[model samples]
Target: MVIPTTSISTDSLTSLASPSPTLDFYDSPEPAFSFLVQRIDSLLDCSSAQKTHHQRRLPSLTSFVRQVYVKCRLSPAILVIALIYIQRLQHELPIDSKGDYDTPHKVFLAAIILACKFNDDSKSRVQSIYQCVSVVYTNIDVNEMERSFLGVVNYDLYVDIKQLCQFIQEHPTLELNWED
Candidate 1:
């Protein structure tokens, strides 16, 4: 009896590594977006109250800051970095439908991941990004998310640092740089 051996080609491996879906499973807008925004606002109010009250404990202050950060979908440092990235992306890239890519959900996940990478001392790996995306979108496949991420970004366009600096200078009063 002769046994048949099959060899897996590079294309097959690449496909298996990053599976593309017929449609984005995580394309739906988060129903909780508004709720999250409200929650962040409430957290900020609480933090302000704490600041006003000298009796408030240090732990309470720390917790409030953490809660606000989590609710707002940001870290203090990452908020700045993400804003810079967005500003540069907007100036350098044309507003073409073809260039305008990624589902809102995917964009949110990418921003979070990018922010984490820029702000946090510890870097969030691709696996962590996959897990984050998976938690938010239960039905979406991780491989598909990774593939979609690569497809959405236009690497050819260099980020315009000067434009970003000007935008930052002009929008000095904007507290949260990347609200969306």
Candidate 2:
């Protein structure tokens, strides 16, 4: 299937590129983009490995994230925000134990939820958001994941416009290219 590109408006881009506070996502988008790309590669690598019985239910985390992006009808900017939150949560709360499969998926869901809440003007209800994620996870699982995500990220969801504009500039063809 061809994955669709998410578009960002010019007004949003201009505002995002301007200087903003430290909490903004675009304040340091370059590093975050680098980190996001590497982390996604690593996760894809992990998901590609042979699965044991314990990991049977887990879908491909990378593909699943893309699916969430498409199913939620999220803008590319929101996708970037979600990715940033995922990175932040991962950094703050590393998975030291063996059962790591579920954690990443949970974090992804939580990041999507947070991103939608912050970026989308017409908000998606929590239940509906959970419903979109429920295909791969239970409601209870999603709730736990959301709570864990909030705790780890300290509920900071502000993304800078500059970093966002930088990301769009760096990935000019992200929306137009269908190579993924």
RMSD in angstroms, all models? Answer: 18.4, 7.9
Q: Please report the candidate that would top TM-score against the real structure.
A: 2
Candidate 1 error regions (>4 Å): 1-73, 92-94, 98-102, 124-133, 138-168, 176-180
| lDDT by residue for model 2 (13-109), tens | 2234433222323332334334444555444223334455435655566556655655655555656777767657656755552335455566667
Candidate 2 backbone collisions, by pair: 16-161, 16-162, 17-161, 17-162, 24-160, 25-159, 25-160, 26-160, 26-163
Q: Cα deviation in Å at residue 97, candidate 2? A: 6.4
1-180 in candidate 1: lDDT tens per residue?
111111111111121122311111122112123322332232211222333222232233224333333444343333333444444344543444232112333333444455444333233343444544343344354345434543444432222334433553565443223221
Clashes of 1: 0
The regions of model 2 sitting more than 4 angstroms off are: 1-5, 10-55, 94-99, 125-128, 166-180
**Ten-residue region with minimum lDDT total, candidate 2:** 20-29
TM-score of each: 0.37, 0.61
lDDT of each: 0.34, 0.55
